[model samples]
Target: MRSSPRLFQYACRITLFTRQNCSLCVNAKQVLSTVWDKHPFVYKEIDVMTPDAKGWQDLYEFDVPVIHIAKTEHGLERPELSAKAQKLMHRFSAEQVMEKMDIISDPKS
Candidate 1:
């Protein structure tokens, strides 16, 4: 079966869910700050303490450095990012990033 190239080409949207006073979250923020500037994509952090951020508390109380991708349709529950999210951040888009890295893909396989 032939697959649509556009679907394969879709860039992943990463939404970093975090809270105050979390060491991991702090570290994640620092890494994102340094790298995202080059990628040219927005990374937002939501504090679980805020009233508006209540919805995040259940899933993130123990896991403070949860990263949610917008691709999930049924909210930010399942399919949460793994520990390797740090490494994956480097896979950001080169077309928009300051330092461009050639991304090669084979459609015919």
Candidate 2:
């Protein structure tokens, strides 16, 4: 008997730590959406004010728009980021976010 081959898809989860009435958070979401148009991935928005994000408020209070990209594979999560990307996480532009996404998604990099 012959068996068919199964194909696996590569996906990453992008979490945006944001707060209500935050201008930076809005800008971040807009940038992320632009990036998503080219390289799509699972996107999640987390509000620091909620109970679910209790501890995060302390860490990301001032950093209203933080992005975390983690790969999902075989039920395991792994972060994919370069040193430059990490530095850009704090304060970055749409172009910078796209650049980071390209770096993380590129298999050869």
Number of the top-ranking candidate, with TM-score as the measure: 2
Candidate 1 — which residues are off by over 4 angstroms? 1-12, 71-109
Model 2: per-residue lDDT, tens digit, 1-109? 6432221144555778889999878778888888788767677777878886667676677877888665444242222322222324445776776666566555654
- Give the per-residue lDDT digits (tens) of candidate 1, residues 18-98: 777777776666665665565433345666667877666665666766554432222343324333232223223323222
Give candidate 2 misplaced runs (Cα > 4 Å): 1-8, 74-91, 106-109
* Model 1 clash tally, residue pairs: 0
How accurate locally, in lDDT, is each candidate? Answer: 0.47, 0.63
> Where does the lowest 10-residue lDDT sum fall in candidate 1?
100-109
Estimate the overall C-alpha local distance difference test score of candidate 2: 0.63
